[model samples]
Target chain A: MGLKRNVGLMEALRYQGKGPMLTYILHRIGGLSIVIFVGLHILAGYLANHAWGANLGIFINSIYENWLFQVFIFFFALFHAINGLRIVILDLWPKLIEYQREAIWLEWFVFLPIYGIALFVIVRSGLGG
Target chain B: MKTKQRPAPLGGFNFDYIMWLFTRLSALAMYLIVIVALTGALLMSARQNMSIADLMRWAFMPNPNHVASTNIPDIEVWKTIFWQVMAILMLFFAGAHGLHGLLNVVEDYISSRRIRMSLRALVLVIWVAISLIGITVIVTS
Candidate 1:
């Protein structure tokens, strides 16, 4: 508590802005989504491995060979991507001492374009008609 | 009595407790997935022979018939278990980079919205890529 009194206006604002708070929340969401994704990943790979005496691997390789699934893959991937970048940005910046809260909000702004480009490229390739 | 040693940077009892809890929860979910799948395979083991289509259909669309006439419970188990193990493994890659960044942020010495956004975006890419590959593997398989 004693250390807090010396905090400047910006420091105080940043603290109130909840960088740590948001991180904690995002961490949980990211963690859960990852788990869902992981579960699916293993099942797919196991099947693809042609395990249980089948060549399911071949089917998986060509999954994006269709349109709908390719799009499904795109959005799931995009959500995870945008959220992930936010977590990273929150951590790497050394200026959390002052503009940290501002930075947290800024994450949303930066995320949009990146998400769009990534989605476009992935969709085009995955759905390459 | 011996003096208490200094706590490790993040090694308090509370931290250890949480880690244990997380491991146990994750482990339990995984164990159940495997057990169910195996039991289903057991019923199918009798008239033994499988193919890629057999595996694909089994994984994506769970049913007693898909498992080669296995019991419904077994196929049901396989339904959720399918693809999870692979995703967990993929997580190892991101875990190395993402978790480290998370901790670094926690211990940040500076705070800037622009910088936060930048790093967040980077990790977002990682998250997206990993998941994309994961989905591609699961639904397609």
Candidate 2:
């Protein structure tokens, strides 16, 4: 609502300049990452299962088989979903914006252990044995 | 150079307020959908010992494994219908949420109102186009 605080490309991309700045950057990145994966998932799933072009089924299957890619997806999803809850809470209670730092710390505290467990599960499953 | 101020609020609200409300609502909806969808996949995958690929195949196609394994005779038919509906809904909401985020980014960096508006329009067009294509894939598959 204020006069535009237009920034240069360098400033725009300089998320590492501050703590909250980094969170903002990562939130956008996390959301965008999931969106990208959604597109890929839809297209690949359609190709693999559809009547006209089941030929590409193996190619799509290979992507799911790739452990590295799967890990990346899991992390993106974890960060996005957790942070999104924080955003929703903050939106509902603007007074808690001051506690943003504590919220993020809690988010990371929860994120690390759960992500570790997810990786363990993936590996234990023999990366989809 | 003089700084331009935003026009007075219309009916005690402004564009920023509307956007704020819109973003919050959409974000919450998108988050809930993602959580339900992912949780279902993870639980089912673990129960079935299914790989992601196998899960995808099983979800979209009328696979025998799922059919024979399910308790309810009509569960597969219900599930296929549910998934198809969810898939399209996810595509639309996710696409809108993503484009709105990107639009805010463009607004942050682009000083000119005209340029920002143009970019937002472009983003919306792209989002709609992609959603249409994705919906088509979901329905016809």
Candidate 3:
């Protein structure tokens, strides 16, 4: 028997292995989110930069200034950036591949706090601080 | 019927292997560009207390603030060129790299070969379109 057939949501959610797939899934999500964000960013940025697009620019700006959107965007960007750096480092030095588990730990431990602080400043300033 | 065995690499060069390599390279470059863009954005926003609309206007237009302060005629020109070039490069590499990675994810998750191929085609088309728009904007700017 090869690939398992037709696993539903609950079945997929139930882990059957020793190693967790959280990071794997996160990496995929991060990549997908960033791509979508980048597309919207380009469209909005272009519109905002246009001569006759002030109203649309304002509309997009209002959305961008939302605290929740900022947090998600920041988190997505940070996660993708840090994890990408890890992958790059490992690829260049395959010997360090063995430390991938640690790399993921370092990614969260070191970067998350940094991002959190940055988020605090951004949100504060964003909200008329 | 679903194919049981993993498909071989696309060609002699190994499409998956090459894409794997390219993804890392492009991702590293993309990360650097994002850092630069983000830092610039944050600084500009904080300095001017700028809304997104204001930021966009300031970015694409000649910087009236800088002109008022520095009285530098070509500074805005250079800044525009720099950001435009950066945007183009970021879009090109990011589009390729992100779509490639997403295609890999599609392959992993989609069991039906037909659907996988179709999704990959869609990703490729969108990526190319976005990249072209990015380049066109930069060129026009």
- Go through the candidates in order and give each one's DockQ: 0.03, 0.36, 0.36
Q: Which should have the higher DockQ, number 1 or number 3?
A: 3
- lDDT tens readout by residue for model 2, A1-129: 555444556766764667566667778777777666666665665566666767675476577667887788777777877787888898799999999989988988988998898788777776565
lDDT of 1 by residue, A1-129 (tens): 112223565765567546557655555555555444444444555555456624565465455445455445444444445455544444445455466556556755665676566556556665663
Best by TM-score: 3
Give each model a TM-score: 0.34, 0.69, 0.74
Q: Is the docking of candidate 3 incorrect, acceptable, medium or high quality?
A: acceptable
Tens digit of per-residue lDDT, candidate 3, span B55-113: 43343322233223332334444356677677667667878888887888888778777
Pick the winner on TM-score between candidates 1 and 3: 3
Give Cα distance to truth, residue B33, candidate 1, Å: 29
Q: What is the TM-score of chain B alone in each candidate?
A: 0.36, 0.64, 0.61
RMSD of each: 16.9, 5.6, 5.5
**Clashing residue pairs found in predicted model 3:** none
Clashing residue pairs, backbone N/CA/C < 3 A, model 2: none
Q: Give per-residue CA lDDT, model 3, range A1-129, as digits (tens).
A: 244455567767786642226666777788888778767655665566677975786587577668778788767767777777887898889999899888878878978797878788778877889
Please, what are the lDDT tens digits per residue for candidate 2 over residues B1-141?
A: 233444343554777677767777877776666556556655544345555444533443322333343433344343466667776676666677777777778865565678878998998887877788677765655
Candidate 3 wrongly placed segments (more than 4 Å): A1-8, A16-20, A48-58, B1-12, B32-83
- Ranked by lDDT, the better of candidates 1 and 2 is 2
Q: Pairing residues by index, what is the TM-score of model 3?
A: 0.74
Q: Which ten residues in a row have the lowest lDDT in candidate 3 chain A?
A: A15-24
